[model samples]
Target: MHPFSRSQEAKEMFQAQSHLYNHTFNFISSMSLKCAVQLRIPDVIYDHKRPMTLIDLASKLRIHPSKATCLYRLMRVLVHSGIFAETVVPRDGKQEEEIKAYVLTPSSCLLLNDKATGLSPFVATMLDPALVSPWHFLGDWLGGNNHEDCRDKLNNPFEAVHGVNIWDYGRKNPEFGNTFNTAMAGDCQLMNLVIKDYKEIFEGLNSLVDVGGGTGTMARIISEVCPGLKCTLLDLPHVVAGLPESESENVKFVGGDMFESIPSADAILLKVCTLGIALL
Candidate 1:
């Protein structure tokens, strides 16, 4: 091959490799977001109520100075993902020594824990190690290795990784169980606030049953709108065992398996697990 032809081929190969590598490691963005939320980076910037300098933000977070550069790198990716915005701030209102500051973008405003519709818990739950570990077994699962992880034998990727279904595993682990429940509640509540715009969807509905409704989050949210419409939330016994006991005017919890029987209703709602490995 000619020298120029070889160089062009090398450039093309480099571009292709970069593209493939970027897509392969895209999960890093989600992991970074999880870290920032866990550390309350967004909350800190929100509390400041103005653009926050990296040094001051770190001080507020009480992070050791050694990780200052790492923190900046984390924030840099977050800004690139549009979760946060970076801007130059003049120190003491002087332009001579400008420092980079972080501000919450519109996309991140929904991550606030104090907000009724905030998705902080949901994001945390989605990114939890217990939930994320199964992804490593996806290739194994697809390659016909999805079975027998010591405690339980199953074909699901999550089961293969955790030895049991997510719900069963969560039931045994209180911390993970609580996190899973809280995450679902936050997601449902946020969706509830959003679904109000589609009033036609709820029209003519007298009663609804929410299958696999963890902690009655979806039922509670929907019932608030459909005051006259009855809502029954059904989930695994272990899951519902930790949910509310008292019944609301329109909402009630039923600790039962959907496969056995779900409370009869005019409509049945299914909130599919998005982790892609959670089995029925």
Candidate 2:
């Protein structure tokens, strides 16, 4: 091959290799974000009420002295991933000397534990070992290597890995079940911001049914924005059992499977019918 052609081919190969490496290690970014949430990094920064120096952050975290540098390295990854922001500021207002400080970005702001829109629970739950372990069996499940009877009955990688469906697994494990419920509620909180703007959609509608509406977070939001629209929240009997009554006259809770029979309404809302929850 010509010399220039050979060099160009090598360059292309190197670019391809870099792409492969990045895609292979993408999980590290997620794991790093999970670590930040586990450490309450966002909450710490948020509560500090100002840009926090690295040393101050470490001190607040109460991590051992030896791990301070490791914490910085972890922060570096999060900063690069846009989960946090780092900037240089004057040390104690002295112009000549500067120190690095970390601050919450919009993304990290969503992870604050105290905020109504906080998604820290969602982050923790999604990255939980029980939820993540199924990915390891994805190839096997797709290759038809799972037990024949199990494969015949199971629907997805999660069921194949855990030997049970997600709902059953949640029922069997109370701690994880609470975490999953909190995560779902946290995730649904974002709807509060946008539901009001779409109030017209509920106009002229007398009633609506929210299928799989866990704990009625979405129902309450809709009812508040569209006061005339009566909202019925439906889920498994166990999921809706013993729930406190809503203050809103427009919202009511009913427990039943979506597949069996959904309450008759002007419209049906199925917000969480995605592949992860529904297909599994």
Candidate 3:
């Protein structure tokens, strides 16, 4: 083929593969986010109070100086994905150095743990390996029947692959359970911001039930902000077990199965698991 014809064919091939390229590299985005969380990059940047240069960030991250180049490459991809932002800062008048400094955008801001509107937990929950691997079995699960009997089969793709529900697995593993709860609490923190904005939702509510309300984070926040409204945290017995006996006047804990029967309340806040939400 002529050189011009070959160039045209190459461009067409690239266009055809563009979507597949996106799909394949999607995991890199998640992994990059995961790396950031693991390295506490968001927290570091937040604490820095200013954009952090690559060397400074690497030092803060406890990464050796030799790995600085690798860090820069990772940051480049993250910046491209909009998880981190890069800016040029001038240190001295003599030379303006092109240093890669990370600044938090709306996306990275949500990853902060201290911020009232932080969504770190949502990220942790969504990216939980236990929860994520189930998606691979979606096609296989959907091939089965649609009856109530299939509910277990349908709702349990994770179990099918990993041999246990996420909660069960978390229970057996303390660190993972902590990570899961942190994520949930983070999500609750952010959600409460929205809920507070819509206070009318609780204007007439004397009592409210947070179904599957692990740790009562959301319910407690609601109860605290709206003192008159009593809150009940309804969750699995296993989840509520060993949690300190309630001392808060506005909030009470009730351990029970939401699938069978929800506790009686003026309002019910059924916080569905994200994995469950995704399946539905």
Candidate 4:
């Protein structure tokens, strides 16, 4: 049958159906991007230092020759999604058929694993099997909890799926806990730049404490900016387990619960938005 064989009304119906299908499977785009990151495609393109042809990239990645076409297909989607850019690159010996090459986009640059501004850890954290598995249960939860409807299933979906709270689950899984901490640290590193943007926030402050500061990444940044200020980092025991207590320059890592009793400080830096100053 030729394309669009039916009446205009049927064609319109088919178009709407196609649109519904497109959105219904939109998670594929997100998964593909995550796969690209896991494969280190962004960093590979950056390491190449120039636009890299698909064949060259595949070869560098050590992918099977038979899968070269599939690699091309994946990159095609990524390029369309703006994770990578395509440009016609001329082969050294052949001028007739130019090979398409890929270059990293500004967005991919932030995903670099080696960069200070890297959000790769964040991506890894979000795309972890544990986190993604929760979504698969969302529909089931809405439908019913084995016997009863979702309304009867009072358990938190994540806890229900994993059998533990996110924090407890992380503490149980060292690898995941480290990744979560690193992801938070990466976010803090990115947010720490705002301190320079707003220097007045720290002005006249003699001391500070970063409540729930993971790995003291943010506290160290603030301490570096104001060396005279004594910075104490307070976090759960598991979180600050391996963090050096010898003072990471101006920041001190204290392993204790934040709810019990926080170390006193002139000013308390809580995340980015909130700040507290103690009375003299």
Instruction: Write model 2 residue lDDT over 186-261, tens digit each, in one string.
Output: 8888988788777787888999999988888899999888888899999887778888889998999998888889
Q: What RMSD does each model have against the real structure?
A: 2.8, 1.9, 4.3, 6.7
lDDT, candidate 2, at 42: 93
Where's the lowest-lDDT run of ten residues in candidate 1? Answer: 145-154
Model 1 spans with C-alpha error above 4 angstroms: 1-11, 144-153, 245-247, 277-280
lDDT of 3: 0.79
CA lDDT, every prediction? 0.82, 0.87, 0.79, 0.80
> Which of 2 and 4 is ahead in lDDT?
2
Model 2 ranges with Cα > 4 A deviation: 92-94, 145-152, 273-280
Q: Could you tell me the lDDT of residue 237 within candidate 2?
A: 78
Candidate 1, residues 17-37, lDDT tens digits: the string is 999999999998999999988
Q: What does the lDDT read for residue 1 in candidate 2?
A: 89
- Overlapping backbone residue pairs in candidate 1 total 0
Deviation from native of the Cα of residue 263 in model 2, angstroms: 1.1
Local error of candidate 2 at residue 2 (angstroms)? 2.0
User: Candidate 3: where is the Cα deviation over 4 Å?
Assistant: 1-16, 91-98, 139-155, 245-247, 277-280
Clashing pairs in 4: none
* Per-model TM-score versus the true fold: 0.88, 0.94, 0.82, 0.80
